[model samples]
Target chain A: MKRSKTMELGVGLFMLAGILGLVFLGLRVSGLSLSVPADTFTLQANFANIGGLKPRARVTMAGVNVGRVSAIELDTDWYDARVTLELDGALEGQLSRDTTAAILTAGLLGEQYVGLSPGGDPETLGDGDTLTDTQSALVLEELIQQFVSNMVRD
Target chain B: MIPRVIALGRHGCDLLEALGRSGLFLAQSALGWPSREGLYLWLRQMHFVGVLSLAIVLVSGLFIGMVLALQGYTILIDFGAEQALGQMVALSLLRELAPVVAALLFAGRAGSALTAEIGLMKATEQLTSMEMIGVDPLRRVVAPRLWAGFVSLPLLTVGFSVVGIYGGFLVGVEWLGLFEGSYWSNMQASVDFIADVGNGMLKSLVFALVVTWIAVFQGYDLIPTSEGISRATTRTVVYSSLAVLGLDFVLTAVMFGGLS
Candidate 1:
C-alpha cells in the first residue's frame, strides 16, 4: 500500500523532536560538564583532620563555589592536612585573611568540601597566603563514639 | 516414566531449535535493512509504534515521578534531607525505572501489537501472497518492523524520563512546598551523566533488540489460525517482559557494581 509522503515526513520530524528533547534533557540534568575553570589563583589551608575531603572538591564562600581543591598533602612539621585550593581570579580580593576555611559535608551522607565563613578583619589574603583558621570534617563515627562513651559514664 | 522423559527431551530440543531458527531469521532481516523503501517503511512503523505509544508512557512516567517524590519526601523529612528529593527521583528514573518500565510497557503495547498484526496477516494469507508476488516478506514486512522497534524504544525511554522528571518537580516543589532551587541543584550534583543517564540508554537499546526480535519472530513463525495468532501475541508479551527484567538485573550488576 502506498502511503502519503508528507505524513511520513511529518512523523519523522516528530521523532527527531522527541530525540532532541532527550538530548537536551540529558545535557541539562546529567552534570557531565567538561568546562573547567582555568583563570584561578591558588590558596592554601591547614587542617588537623581532613577526613575523606577529596581533591577537586569545591571551595565555597557564602554557599557559592569560588574555587576547587587542587591538591592535598600532609605537612610534616604540623602533621595536618595541607590543602591547596584554586580560587577563581574573578574572586581574588573577595576573600580576606580571616576567611576561615572549614571542611563541611554537602548533605548528611554526601561528600565533603571546603566552606568559607568570612571573619572581621582589615587585612586581605594574597594569592599564596595560608588561611590560619581551618576546621576539619566532623567524623560521624567519632561523634557517635563520644555520645556512647558519655552515656556509659553517666 | 519413559514417556515423560522422552517428552522432556523433545521439549528441550524444540526450544533450542526455535532459538537457532530465530537467530537465522534475525540475521536475514538485518541483511535486508539497507533498501530505501525499507527505511521509509521503518519510519512509518516508528510513527505507529513510538508516536502512538507516547501518551501511555508519559502518563505512567508522570505518575511514577509523583509517587517517587511523595514517598521520598515522607522519608527524607525524618532525616531533614527532603531537599534531595529531586536527586532521588532523577536517580531512580535514569538508573532504573525509565529503561525497565519503558521496555516493559513497550513490550505490552508495541511488541504484542506487532506480533498480533503479523500473525493476522499470516492467517489472512497476506504474507504468503506477498511472497508469491515477487516481494520478499523479510525485506518488505519483517525488517521494517524490526528496525522500527530498534529505533522507537530508546527514544520513547528518553521521552518517558523527561516527563517523569517534570512530574517529580511538580509534586516535590509545587505541591509539597519544597525549595525549587534545591530540587534541580541536588539533581545536577548527584546524577552522573555517564554512569546513570548514559547506561540507562544502553539498557533500553539492548531491550529494543530483545523485544523486537521476540515480537517479529513470534509473528513470523505463527500458525495461520486464530488460536495461533492469539497464542503468539500472548507469548510476545510474556517472553519480552521476562527477558527485559532479567537483562535489567544483569546490566545493572555489570554497569553499577563494576563501577564501585
Candidate 2:
C-alpha cells in the first residue's frame, strides 16, 4: 500500500527473478535437478566389466541418450556387474529382450556407459527382466596384446 | 613489570568491552527494526548495492571466466580433453570466484558506501538529533542497510557466475574453436545443483552477513568526526575483505572437506 513498501516489493521480486534465472541456468549447466521428473522406468543389464561405468551414467542408443544408469552392483557368482537402467517412459516399448547392451566409452578418453543395439525379438522388456545379451568393457591393454599377437602370427 | 602487566590487562579489557558493545548494537538494531519503514530502506540499499555495483561485477566476472577458459584450455589440451573447459570454468566461478570476488567488490563499493553514509550521518549529528527526538537510529538507519546486504549479495553472486560462464564459453568455444556440444555436456554432467550451486549460495550468504556486519558496526560506532568517519569506512572495506576470505576457508572445509 505504501510507496516505499511497493518499491521494496518490486525490487525483491526483481532480485528473486534474477536468482531464479540463475538457478535455472546453473542447474542446466551443472546437469542437476531439484526434483527429478518421474516419467521413467528401470531395466537391468549385466556386463562382465563395467570399466568405470558409474551409476548415473548415460545410456545411449544410436548416440542418443534415452536413459541413465541408475545403479551398478557386482554379482559374485558371475563376477559381472549388474547395471540398472532408468529410461524414459516412451522408450520402454522400443526395447526388446534380445537387445544387446555393451559398455562403451564416449570419445577417445571419456566416461563409460551402456550402449544398446536393437535386436529382432518380439518380446518387449519389463521391470524385473534382464537383458541377456551384453558385451563387457574393452580394455586397451588386451587390444594391444591382441594386436601384437596378430603381428607375430602374420 | 607491574605496569606492563597492568597495561596488558587494560588492553584485553578494552577489547572485550568493544566486542560486547558491538554485539549489543547489532542485537538492538535487529530487535528494534520497524518492518514497514525497513521495507523502503531495504529497497534503497538494494538499489545502491545491486544496480550501482552491477557493472563492476560483470566486468570482473567476465574477465575472470575468460582467463579461466584460456588457461584451462592449455592444461586440458595436453590430455586431449578440451571438452572439459566448461566444467573447469563453471566450477571455479560458481564455487570460488563469483562469490569471493563479488563480495570483495561489494565490500569496496556498497560496504564502504554504507559505512561512509552512516559515519557521515553520525559525524553531522543527524543520528544524535533522531535520538534526541526519542527515535532509535539503529532501527531507522542501520537495520535496513544490513538487511539489504543480505538480499543483494546472493543475487549479485549468482549473476556474476552466469556472466563468467558466458565469458568462459566465448573464449573456449567461439575463440579457440573447441567443440561446443562437449563443452556444455561435460559441464552439465559434472556440475550438480545441490553440490555446487547450493553450496555456493550458502557461501555467498555467509559472506553477505560478515560484510554487512562489519560495515554497519564500523559506521554505528564511528567517533563522530570527519577523519574518524573516513577511517571507519576504510576499516569496513578492509575488515569485510579479510573476514570473507577467512570465513570462506572455514566454510569450505566444513561444507566440502568430507564430501571430496
Candidate 3:
C-alpha cells in the first residue's frame, strides 16, 4: 500500500510538472514580440472585406508588424467590414490622414493581414479616427469564379 | 439450402448475444449507486490507476514527440517546407498521437491489472462470497475500477500531450536547429484551442470510458479457473487497444467533419 501511494505521488507530480511546463511555454510563445511595444493607442480601419482576417493577425507596414488586428465587425446598415487595430504609440505619429488600410494575403494561400500604407497627408490620424479609404482582400475563389464565368460567356 | 439457413441462424444468434451482453452491462452501470464506501473505494482505485501510470506515459510521450519532430522535419526539409514543422508536429500530436498513446498505455497498465484482479477474485470465489453475503459486487468492485479508469485516462492523456509537445519543441528547435521563436510562434498561430487540443481531450475522455468498460466487463465475467484469469487479462489488453484505435478513427471523422 505504501509503495502504491509513493508511485501515485510520483505520477501526480510528473503530470503537474508537464502541465505547468506547457502553460508556461504557451504564455511565453503568445507573448513573443517583434512589433512595436504594447503601450499604444488603438485605431479603427473600415474595410469592405476582411476575408480570412483573424484576431491576432499582424498589422504590417512596409513588411514590419507595427500592430495587431484586435477585432473585426460588420456595419449592418452600410454592409461594410470594420476592423479594430492596436497601433504602437511610437509608430502612431507616422500614420497620416491619407493612410490606406489594405487587406493583403501574407503568403500564397496564407492568412490575411492588414497592410498599412502611410499616406502623404501632413496630419496624422488620431486614436479614435477611422481610416475611410480601405482596400478589401482579394478572394481567390471569387476571382476564379468570375474568371470561369467570363470565359464561358466569351 | 438447409446448411445456409443454419449458418444464418447462428449469425443472428451471435449478434443477439453480443447485443444482450452490451445492454446488460449498460444496465448494470446505470442502476449501480455510489455509497460512501463505494466512493472511498473509487478514490483509492483512482489513485492507483491514474497516479501510478504517469511516469510511463511521460517517458513514452517524450520519445514519441521527439521521433515525430525528427521524422517530420526530415520530410518537410526534403520539400523545402521545413518552416511548417511546428504546425505539423503540434497538429498531429493534438489530433491523433496524444490520446491514442495515452489510451494504449492505460490499456497496458490499468486495463490488464483490472482484468487480472477481477479474474483472480472470481477464480478464488471472493466475488461469489461477496454476492452471497448480500453485497453488490458491481458497486463494490467493478464500479470502482471502472470509475478509476474513466478518471485516470484523461489525466494521463493531458500529461502525455504536454510532455510530448515539449519533446517535439526540443527536437525541432535544439536538435534540428530550427528557429525556436518562429517554431513556437507558428504552432501558437496555427493551432486553434477548439479544433486541436479541445478535440484531443474530448476524445481522450471517451477512450477512457471504452478502456475501463472493456477491462472491467472482461474481468467480472471471467470463468472460474486460473486459466480463465490469464486468458481474460490477455483479451482485455488486445480488445481495449483495438477499441481505442477504432474509436480514434470514428472520433477523428466526426471532429474534422464538423470543423471543416
Candidate 4:
C-alpha cells in the first residue's frame, strides 16, 4: 500500500509538471493579460472576405499590433463578413473618417489580420461607426488560380 | 506435383481459418459491447493506459520538441529563414510528431504489457474458465481494454503536443536566442485550427484503436504454452507499431488532400 501510494504521488507530480509546463509555455507565447482601462473602442469593418481570420487575431496599424479582432459576424443581406476590431485608446484620435481597413496576411500563407491604413482626413471616425470602405482579405488560392490562368493565356 | 499442390492448399486453408477466427473475435467484442460491466472495465483500463503513461509522454514530448526546434532552426538559418523555426516546430509537432510519437511510446509500453497479461491469462486457461462460468469474456475483458485504449491514446497525444510545443519554445527562445515575440507570432500566424491540432487528434484516435485491438487480439488468441505467449507478446508490439505507422500515413494523405 505504501509503495502504491508513493507511485501514485510520483505520477501525480509528473502530470502536474506537464500541465504547468504547458500553461507556462502558453503564457510565454501568448503573453499575460493585464486589465487596463478600455481606452480603445471597437468598430465594425465590413469585408467581402475574411479568409482565415479568427478571434484573438491581431489588428495592426503600421505593422504594430494595436488591438485584436473582438468578434466576427456575417452580414445578413450581402453575406459579407463584419469584423469587430478594438483599437488602442491612444490611437483612437488618429483614426480619421478616411482610414481604410484592409485584411492583410502577415506573410505568404500567414494568418489573416486587419491592417488599418490611417488616412489624412480632417474628420475622425466616431466610436461604434462602421468603416464603409474596407478591402477584403486576399485569398491565396484565388491568386494562384488567377496566376495559372494568366500563365496559360500567355 | 499433386502432393505439393495439396500441401499448398492445406497452408492456404489454415491461413483462411486464422483470418476467420480473427474476424469472429472482432465481431464478438463489438457485439458484446455497451454493457454496464463493459463500461466499468473500460474506465479502469483507460485510467491505467492514459493516467499511468503521463510521465513517459511528457519526458519524450519535451525532448522531441527540443530536437525539432534545433533541427528546424539549423535548416532555416541556411536559407535566411530562421525566424520561421517556431511555426515549423509548432506545425510539425501538432500535425505529425506528437501523435505518432505518443502512439509509438504507448505501443512500446502499454501495448507490450497488455499483450503479455492477456497472453498469460490465455495460457493459464483463465479466459476459458471465465467462458465456462457463463461470463462473456468480451465484456469482462476485451471491451474495457479496447475502450480504455480509444480514450487514453488521444488524451496522451494532446498532452504530448502541448508539452512538445512548450519544449520547443523553451529551446528556441532561451537557448537559441530567438526573439520571443517573433517565435510566438510566427507560430500563431502559421498554424491553422483544423489542419494541425484536429488532424493530430484524429490520427491519435485511430492509432489507439489499432494498437489496442492488435495487442489484445494477439494476447487473447495465444497458444496454450509459455513460448507461444512470449512469441505473441513480441508479435503484438511489432504488428501494432507497424499498423500505427501505416494508419498515420493514410490519415495524413486524406487530411492533406482535404485541406488542399
The candidate scoring highest on DockQ is 1
TM-score of 2: 0.86
Best by the lDDT measure: 1
Error of 1 at B236 (Å): 0.4
Give me the runs in candidate 4 sitting further than 4 Å from their true place.
A1-59, A64-97, A100-114, A122-154, B1-20, B30-40, B258-260
Fnat of each prediction? Answer: 0.53, 0.58, 0.19, 0.06
Docking class for candidate 3: incorrect
> Whose DockQ is higher: candidate 1's or candidate 2's?
1
Model 2, span A1-154: residue lDDT tens: 3355565665776588567757666667877667878688888887887777888888899889888998899888788788899988887777877999999987788888889899998889876678899998988988999999999999
Candidate 3 lDDT, A14-106, residue by residue in tens: 557647644543453233334545587788887777788988888889988788888888988788888899987887667889899899985
Model 4, span B89-205: residue lDDT tens: 888887889889999999988988888888888888888999999997777887778777777787777788877887888999999999988888787665666556667678888
Q: Compare the candidates by TM-score and give the number of the best one.
A: 2
What DockQ score does model 2 reach against the true complex? 0.45
Record all residue pairs in model 2 with backbone atoms less than 3 Å apart, i.e. clashing: none
Q: Is candidate 3 or candidate 4 better by lDDT?
A: 3
How much is A142 displaced in model 1, in angstroms? Answer: 1.5
TM-score of each: 0.84, 0.86, 0.76, 0.70
Off by over 4 Å in 1: A32-57, A67-101, A107-111, A116-134, A144-154
lDDT of 4: 0.80
In order of TM-score, best first, we have 2, 1, 3, 4
Model 1 Cα lDDT, one tens digit per residue, A33-69: 5576467888889999998898868888888978789
